[model samples]
Target: MKKIYCLIYILFTLPLLSQEKEGITHSGQLTGNPPFPIENYSELDNPKSTSETLWNKKNRTFVSWANTDVRYNKEIPAPIALSQETLHLSAWKGEQLNAQLIISAHRKSLELNFEISDLSSSQSKIESKNITGGFVRYVMTDELNKDGKGACGPRNHKEFDSTLVADPIDHLNDRLSIAKNTTRPVWVTINVPRDITKGKYTGEIKIRDGDRILKKLGLEIEVLDRVLPKSENWKFHLDLWQNPYAAARYYRTDLWSDEHFAAMKQDLQHYVNAGGKSITASIMNRPWNGQTYDPFQSMVTWRKTIDNKWSFDFTVFDKWVEFMMDLGVKKQINCYSMVPWRLAFEYFDEASNSMKTIETKPGEKAYSEMWGAMLKAFATHLKKKGWFGKTYISMDERPMDVMLETIKLIKSADKNFKISFAGSFHKELLERIDDYCLALGENYPQEILGKRQNRGKISTFYTSCAHPRPNSFTFSPPAETAWYGWYAAATGLDGYLRWAYASWPLEPLLDSRFSTWAAGDTYLVYPGGRTSIRFQKLLEGIQAYEKIKLLRREFIESGEKEDLKKLDTLLNGFASSEIIEKDVAQSIKKANIQLNSF
Candidate 1:
């Protein structure tokens, strides 16, 4: 009976299997992207030689953005076109597939023919004679074509090449397969081995489909050099969240001019000199008055008048950027604005012909235009000087759609774009954050936000291990924030971020008087020669805690699975133990205070 049943099942399913395969027809072709060259020079335009310039000067990443209405303003050459193509690597490990390429050509029917070559273990490299392990798998979509369904939104599709690949090799051992195209922007991808060496790796991907060769685009992949093993003890990422009330506000001319600038620089230099690595400066012109600068406002108003062509004046901001650079401060500029609050008008009294106003209704158009101009100017300056990855652009507390658009514009202008944002653990911001970091995974979020994204974008909490305000008068500082930080890190937060490490110094800069961060009357030492005994102890504890966190990152990043597991077990074992329970609990409390203080 069993044999008979088996035969009957196979007999019936055999017809279904044949039908399924018959229906699984190739609907489209997987074509390589066309070449679109944006002349990327190395370092800068050398003053020494006009013709002696090397074709490939330095290692660089491609730039990308979302604007189709490109009007050639010969007055200024368009910024070096970002990435010649959008490189996608959505494929996983040990997959039979090699890569995925999407072109902006929209044509009906016809299957895509892909040419897969195994650069790893193949002979006669140029010829497609030896097809190895990998094969192409793709489904064509008008989505990323010359229509709105692509990276930017609807009606925004312009011709461009976008390539996605799954290479198993490391940075040094990358292989490329190109697609050919003439009219549309072509996409190309280079797959590198996981164990790529730490050095400059250069290669080229040529796009072609059948007889026609599309274009040739250069590719540069740089594997970051490993950091000092000892320095890995401390996590050095911190956020600057000081608003007007806390920040010492003086006239821009007074504070930013020579005298004040020098003083400020000296102070920061002292801080870095003492022991500071990174500081994110929240950019706000004035202090926040709850009514006017209230970040709690739901709707952000913007002037509808200014379209894509609008521009804003950012003279003062230029100086700000310069000052930050001069101070040797690694800063993240926040393009955050309150729409309705920025608008000067509130209610109008028709009887007296008087209109109530707020602080300034800095329209969104003006903000957007100003930011774009600033980025273009800054990016161009950096590119010319070649500080591509040194600066970052950040947006805090803005709508997702608007922020995404802003990111597109900034990225379109410069491929090496970085941004960050402040997020709330509240339910609203937590849901669907992956969409925001849709392109870059959570590891390297250009738009730094408070929330976390898994496999999508990188994020860190604002203050999960420290309090904005510490009880200076009392010697005891909260230990709860530390626990919270640990919890967040455990849940996959990239890092822990705190705002305003030291706002007000208590005894002539000995200790912070107002905040709970104070540890007795002692002041932590600053580069500017300010220190308090209590704050010093507090800083010591923080430094130690952060060191533990950093060790966790290094362990995980080391790619030693067993070591990671061991460390995890050790950390978890001590998590609830009395040995460090108070420290962890106090850290959590401090973190909560800081979050709620806002």
Candidate 2:
């Protein structure tokens, strides 16, 4: 009996000894064998945690401590607080996932360096491409203008107010100093390669201040056998208007120069990597005036010969096309402005050795003739360059009469021309356009939209200053940006379009506010480097949409109408509400779960 008692004591003590060896204390503290003194650290899924170890070991642990609630009130436009929890990220094979963690510095300014452990075993490990850092971005916000116009109406050229009167707000940066008692968001992205092996990979992200380990956050990625297709397979026709001229202005360089080209290439590559499909091409000067960037010159130039014959110079235009093609913008080259802002066109006149303008005030004979000839020349060039089929003559926020007139002129030039417009949804205009990007709140007959979509017409919706909800801007929540994709799937729309991609303010990275438009209106991306949180959220939304599309296809192939109905129900419900990030993630998770079961 004494011997048996000794055995029981040994068994219990042995386990305790093992726990101690692993740096786990009887008080449940993880004092993992580090040189420095580490204490007062707790893990939470959110900032408002009452206890440590809020989840299972397999789950991600967000580290945070109890603190006073940080609110965004009127007194403080940009208040910073510590993140309530650490960040957790999960991704499938061939998918990229990102998460933001809030870090607060309470006493004084602090700088923290972070490194991740190798998530590998003897057989397999996550590739360097699969794990990367320094992709951090700051989160900024502005007060919503309550008195602003609600939705963009017909020919509504007026600006939508964001009411951002204060200086621009941004979370403290990781590379830069974090102010005392200030909070900031740090973003980390993980890309699971398409050919990665299936299994659970575990690692730790250690936050350090010099030689001291401030915190060791855990990371886990579950790589499945499933492969996410390329961004091109995402059926949505996403068009974020590009501003190469913005690149030049921001960088203080001449257009198409080595410096300007490099900057523009960076911005364009960022857009394409984030699932932007439609490329905006300027065929005339100042396609949309009074906008973010300066009036861009027409890529195509025309000259009258010494003998009074008309000639075209395709040098600059050809270079632009080649550059776009090199960047893999073969999906859709959307030519800006068959009828641009204020119905004006400008061109360089080599014969006169000067630049000239043609204004299309009603019944302006010179304007009509000049525009007609220009359209004819553009159509012929597009056809000869093999860009006609993938090209669309685009206009923005113009009146019905103007759009119709522009379409007529283009069609007369080339009968097979495809026209794309972002205007108020007009029933009569639905059948006339190959691509109609309507505002969200426009009174449109669903039957017409459905019918147009059925006939292979590309139907999309756009949001700007007027239609602020469900927007990809700093003021809006990241989840709302992601919901655009799910919303498109539910509504049976082809895709989404935002007016600006790189239209920067005077100091875009510092402040996204614009004088004429809403804050964060001029651009989705910053000037010199890195993408915005809104942009990343947009990518997530696109990924979610693509996942849903693939699952729906599988369900159809497998004849699982019930599963398909369930997914549709979830998506429709999400679409109808002011969606949160959790709901979007849950919906995607549930849909994937259902898909995997098949």
Best candidate per TM-score, number?
Answer: 2
| Residue 9 accuracy (lDDT) in model 2 | 15
Please list the C-alpha lDDT of all candidates, in the order they appear: 0.32, 0.60
Model 1 is weakest, by summed lDDT over 10 consecutive residues, at 1-10
Measured with C-alpha atoms, the lDDT of residue 127 in candidate 2 is 60
Candidate 1 has an lDDT of 0.32
The residue ranges of model 2 lying beyond 4 angstroms of the native Cα positions read 1-89, 121-123, 135-141, 146-174, 304-310, 350-352, 361-364, 443-447, 577-598
Error of 1 at 511 (Å): 10
Candidate 2 residue-wise lDDT, 149-229, digit = tens = 332221111223322221121222334444444344445567777777888776767665556666676666767667788
Error of 2 at 584 (Å): 7.4
